[model samples]
Target: MKYFRVDLITATPNPQRCIYVGMHQDYSESFVGENRINWPDEKKAGEICVKRLLAGERGHYGPMEHVQIVFNIGWFPHSVMQQARTHRIGVSFDVQSMRYTGNRINQVAKGLLDIEEVFYLRPIGHYVDRKGRRYNYTQTQRNIDLQYCEQAAKRYYDLIEDGFAEEHARGILPFDYRQHFIVSFTLRGLLHFLDLRSKRDAQLEIRELCRLIWPHLENWAPEFAAWYQQKRLYKARLAP
Candidate 1:
């Protein structure tokens, strides 16, 4: 369908400063709230945060939990959500549910929406399997798959038209129906998610999701993102 996008909903402002305060509070006996008046700039705070807390892989992730970010993920396939939910760790999701929101399906049935707009299919290409088997997904195969999706969508809509419940009618829909969702994570959780999903072995769609998320993180916490890009990104978890 040529659409997968992420929009930043909200994030803790001055995240590096938050991290610095959290990290600094851990070792300080005084009330950090008052002492934070002397806190450095976010960039410098992030540099110090990296130096003091993450430089040698200190394994101190508590500070990162203080910063929170949320995103509205749009037009990703159900499979991506399925895969991401499997390893959610400490993330939260508020997905568009078929049971409650079926306007797009109705649109498809009324010919107001293209099936391609409501569903996702991998483009014709060579893709690798978990066993390292590389196979070409031909256009012929894709067309056949498209037909199956079309049939399924027709059935789903027809059932709905016949007074079937959304919960029941949704059972006939394509497995890869495009969905929008809201997801939130702490700074540490976000990096850990990237560690797991941005790897070379991860599914392509979710990997693309992580790719879209990275820029937002970079803009939010430049120093932390830079350190993560150099160390943890697509390599290994920064901590247990």
Candidate 2:
């Protein structure tokens, strides 16, 4: 939780109004952008879009694709990105590549970066897996995992120093190494992603990623976020 984050990079200004404009364009005989004088303000526009673009009888979503936001995701494990990438339609990602970057591994090997900063382990706590089996990830097991990460980093760095390519040397690194990525999504795409990753059965770390993304969505488009929170958040209500 300490390292995981979602920072907003940029978003469409008056995104709710932009969504409404798209909706207006779909039906208006006249051009919508040219009729901005009659368009609703951001909040009002958000309300209108939710009602017209996504409400029960008028379940239109094409206009939601018109609004977009970008984020810089930080320090989530590589596995999180792996899971996040499964739903790629209308989504874009530029992830930190271990193949081209080995400074963090070197830093860990040199005792500059803490092992935990380079790898992930679940906190020592009880957890139940998909089947009804329950178990505890104790402190001792976690300590062993930390040691494993340190050893892997050292081996990876040693291989690099011995003229191994970064890509070749990285084979020894842990699967859940920390990584950062830049991602952008259309509003509809964002909703579709949340529908999958924010559900009860989703992996815990990826759910955390979805949790982190929500605040930025709310701040940028309050009305849409509100509608989503009430009707869709965590319910696995797949966005159409």
Candidate 3:
């Protein structure tokens, strides 16, 4: 099985500047002279921006919509992606097409010949029993699950080999199969995503994804990160 991972790819140039531009928009009519005004220190501006946001000032969130970020997320179960796609506002996704890329297998075990490799996500807490104790699946159980997925992969490949279209052949593939994608979101949208997905009640796989992405976001915008952390509005808690 492959573990989930998230990578920060790129972000808006001078993200603080973008925030300032958005903040300026709300007060643009008040400027007496030239419309453009320069803030000497971007960090100071960011701190002020975060303060206004935390104070619940009107239109503060509008500025956050200007800052944008992109991430390369991959190797997680298709089920996790299904949950992630629910947050559709101010965000965009470019996902791998199983219909087009079904023939490509990037994972191959060392010293294993003619093996149809199938990857899955082992969720952190989904296997817990009713007593609140973690239930470790025995080797036999693991093998049984793997066998089922392997059979599905075999059927999918066989259909393709028999001249069936990939779109049709992909029907046999399991939802546990791994997939990757590039996701983009505005700062406001990302905060909303983190708020919902990082919650204790969120899906385990996606919460893990949020845990991985949070520190990177903190690094990108420390002031805003601090405000979010302090507010605790999203129930953002890491998995044990």
Candidate 4:
């Protein structure tokens, strides 16, 4: 099986301080809640900012004090779930979860695979063949083990339904069960996260997600976005 690595970095601070560079056409000082708003027209300002960012203008935002961002990390059951949920109370995220209501944790049982294809049958062979020698093969033992784990989960869930303490019953669930969570970060926090998570050393899942998000931020908050990219480059050079 392929190990899954996921990372999520949130924006630092809150939106209260950061002046959103874009969204001027429809955005106003009132929209962002600024009493001493200064501009010819909120609509015109927003329009111009959005246009410029989309056109690739990057610089220092009005003030870095107001912007904040957060991220939701996704991966296998045990990997990022715990960390994500932990960040939920402290940070904010944009992912869905089953933790709110008492519900069954999602499950997608799979053994380690030589390739990325999904298979639903038992395979009988050594785990891996190397130099004409097979190793790590316990022959069907791995499958049997996972099956037993699934069964145990089902039994524990039933027990909980029958009045057993859920806290204890839940102990039986394995780490691979899929979970979801939310995390909130400010613009500053996001920059910090990206500085670490968006680099070549970052995990694949987080890095891919960063690639998807950076462009959007570049459009939404041009100055702040540009600052993040620059910060990332500087930090990378410092990595030994």
Top TM-score hit: 2
Q: List the residue pairs that clash in candidate 1.
A: none
Per-residue CA lDDT of model 4 for 118-208, tens digit only, reads 1112234444333455465364776776666656556665766688775666667554444444555544445555555566754444455
- For each of the candidates, the C-alpha root-mean-square deviation to the true structure, in angstroms, is 1.3, 1.1, 4.5, 9.8
Clashes of 3: 0
lDDT, model 4 = 0.45
Q: Which of 2 and 3 is the better model by TM-score?
A: 2
Tens digit per residue, CA lDDT, model 2, 1-240: 878989999999999998888888878999777877999999999999898877673558888888889999999999999998886558999998888878999999999998888898888899999997999999999999999999999999899999999989998888999999999999989989998999999999999999999999999999999988888888987776
Regions of candidate 2 where Cα sits further than 4 Å from its true position: none
Instruction: Give the Cα-based TM-score of candidate 3 against the true structure.
Output: 0.82
Model 1 Cα lDDT, one tens digit per residue, 21-76: 98888888889898766999999999999999888888678889999999999999
TM per prediction: 0.96, 0.97, 0.82, 0.48
lDDT order of candidates, best first? Answer: 2, 1, 3, 4
Poorest 10 consecutive residues of model 1 by lDDT?
231-240
For the record, the alpha-carbon RMSD of candidate 3 to the native fold, in angstroms, is: 4.5
The lDDT per prediction is 0.88, 0.89, 0.70, 0.45
